[model samples]
Target: MLQRPPAEPGMREDEVDTPALILDLDAFEVNLDAMAARLAPTGAKLRAHAKTHKSPVIAGLQRRRGAVGQCVQKVGEAEILAWGGVDDILVSNEVVSPLKLRRLAALNALARVQVCCDAPEAVPLLEEAAAAAGHRLGVLVEIDVGAGRCGVAPGPEAVALAERIAASPHLRFGGLQAYHGGAQHRRRPEERRAAIGGAAEAVRRTLEQLRQRGLDCPIVGGAGTGTFELELETGLWTEIQAGSYVFMDADYGRNEEAPGFRQSLFVLSQVMSAPRGTGRAVLDAGHKALPTDSGLPLVWGRPGLRYVGATDEHGALAVEDAAVPALGEKMRLVPGHCDPTVDRYDWYVGVRGGRVECLWPVAARGAMA
Candidate 1:
């Protein structure tokens, strides 16, 4: 069930309810502008992934800043974006289910929809769906590119899959989905450089084979906020599929070289319990609110106070240099992982200049297939 707005326009940030998803409007817009400026000099265009924000409203903002399209991880997310008036969407991940493929293919009338396929066997299922829908769907060949997740090997295997997609009467070759997800979080700059360098070589080999086969791969899409600079330097990927640039998290901050975007998204929690002499306080956000899979949430803007642990419904804060937070004191928390943490909330309380400005729904919140 969707929750009511935790805050309204003109309300002070402190007056907003606890455990709400907060967006610092200024920082968010700055991040958007920064990404646009960063990519303007490069050949790549932004295909901001909807799997991050899950809001078509945010997608629209990205489009206004000159994003080419949006990419999603699930068919439901594509439906949400298409129905919400986003005209272009790519399911960067593969969809093998005939049922899901049919639904995605049917959206072609409303938008330019695409999906990835690493296996040749999945081509027939996709063809059937596109044939039934009477719409030609775009299919990208997903090469492993060092992620070791969902993709075929780069050279002949990848070209073979692309050929399979091209030969299908109902499917057109889109390009390559070569995202190195694991490389994005690598701590050191050299580590990231080396990882993306290998990925670029793999993509180069695959592209060469595609050209030799007379296949025209129009789009090469992949890059996250962490390693987008490296991908941009290559001039290989035509579409940059970065999502987290708009909402920086603690995990991204830990990278040695730093992701250039500002921290904008936060879980607005309050000190619910603070007993005298305890040297700690409990917050209203925890496992159910700020996920710790990427590491514990950071205490934003509060010096010497650390978010050390969490339970089901509570976050333990070690209070040291900073005075104990009074009960009902609202604070912003930078979640460890922005993507999953976003799914935990139904609405984003947009704040600017310490006051509420707008409330946008987490429209595609649980779009898991």
Candidate 2:
């Protein structure tokens, strides 16, 4: 069930209900423009990962700014984006279930949809579903470019999978999915460079192998916000899937030389308790409202304040100064991880100049199939 919206237009920011998902519209627009401008010179297009924003409203905004389309992780998310009028989308992960493949194939009537496959056996299952739907499904061979996750090994292994996808009567072999997910959070610039360097080499060798097999690889899609520049330098990755650049989190911000993006997403929590002289305060938002996987949320713009810990319903704030936040004082928290933190919200309370401007539904939130 959808909960009541936390705030309405014309309301002051402080008037919003506690524990709301807040978006700084000014910063968000800047981030959007900055990302487009940065990628424009590289000749690579943006296929902004919708797995982070999960909203077609944001996707539309991104498209207006030159994004080719959106990238998602699940069939359900693709369904949401397609139903919401996003014409092009890529399920940038492997899908195996027969029922899910059928659903994916059915979406061809509404949008141009693509999915990744790492195994040759999965190709026929996908072929059968696409044939039943009477459409050719676009398939990318995901190469394990150091992120030992759901991708086939580079070179011969990846070429073999691509050959299977190309031979399928109902599948169109789209290029490689060589995203280095683990490298996106490497704290040092050199570390990220090395990681992406290895990934690029693997992609290079795989492309060569695909060519030698008489196969044409059209798109080399990969790269997140952290290492997009490096991938761009390699002149290999054609589609940049940098999602968190629009709403940077504490985890991304921790990088020594992080990408030039502002912190646009926040969890708005109100102070519910402040024991006298305890140097601590309690916030209404906690584990249930914010993600802690990357680490605790940062107290936005509060230099001396720290989010020490969180329970299910409360967050412990460590007050560095003697001035503890008064009761009902509103605080904005920059989430540790933007992706999962975004999944916890139902609506994005877009604020501009400290006033509520708009509310956009998290259309694909929890769309985990």
Output the lDDT of residue 96, model 1: 93
* Regions of model 1 farther than 4 Å from truth: none
Give the per-residue Cα lDDT of candidate 1 at 169: 95
The runs of at least 3 residues in candidate 2 whose Cα sits more than 4 Å from the true structure, single-residue gaps closed, are none
Q: For model 2, what is the C-alpha lDDT against the true structure?
A: 0.93
Q: TM-score per candidate, in order? A: 0.99, 0.99
Residues 224-303, model 2: lDDT tens digits = 99999999999998999999999999999999899989999999999999998788999999989987889999998878
* Candidate 1 lDDT by residue in tens digits, 235-288: 999999999999989999999989988999999999999888989999999989
lDDT, residue 310, model 2: 89
Estimate every model's Cα lDDT from 0 to 1: 0.94, 0.93
Q: After TM-score superposition, what is the CA distance of residue 193 in candidate 1 from its true location, in Å? A: 0.4
